[model samples]
Target: MSSYSNDNTTMETTTTREDRLGYNNNTLKIVVGAFITSVAWICLLFTLIVFFAIFKSGQLKKDTINMLATLYCWTTAIYEDSYT
Candidate 1:
């Protein structure tokens, strides 16, 4: 047998435990997250619909296409500049 020395080893814990002094740890995060996400999406959709209603019939489509084109051009310019 060998000597039981405590000089070359640590004296720390080897297990993990959660502490709940006065709170609940079993929360419905998934359900709440899904609910918040769905609400955000619905709000965004309604905002888009209201925006379209405010503008002309096809104005929103035209504006979105124009913005997308501008974004594409900007990305391409940046990419070309990076290669130089």
Candidate 2:
């Protein structure tokens, strides 16, 4: 009984040591999952930034158009007075 118990202990210790020495399947899976999630988050952030940039560009165009119209109206009024 003592010898049998000793053999079991030795086998357990050896298996534990071997398994602890390197990356296991579970560890690899976790690492891959983390990397993929990080990439996805980065892509999401990039998409949000692009959306914000496009929105700001559109607002700037609208402001520019409004300014040009105002300038055109003032210039037309001035020319009309000068002609009269």
lDDT of each: 0.54, 0.56
lDDT of 2 by residue, 10-32 (tens): 42224455476875667766776
Clashes of each: 0, 0
Angstrom error at residue 62, model 2: 16
Badly placed stretches (over 4 Å) of model 2 are 1-13, 16-18, 59-84
- Candidate 2 to truth, TM: 0.49
Off by over 4 Å in 1: 1-27, 57-84
Residue 74 displacement (Å), model 1: 27
- How well does candidate 1 match the true structure in TM-score terms? 0.36
lDDT of 1 at 79: 41
Worst 10 residues of 2 by lDDT: 1-10
The digit string of per-residue lDDT tens for model 1 on 1-84 reads 233438797465433244334334444554565566565556556555666674656556777757645655654554444333
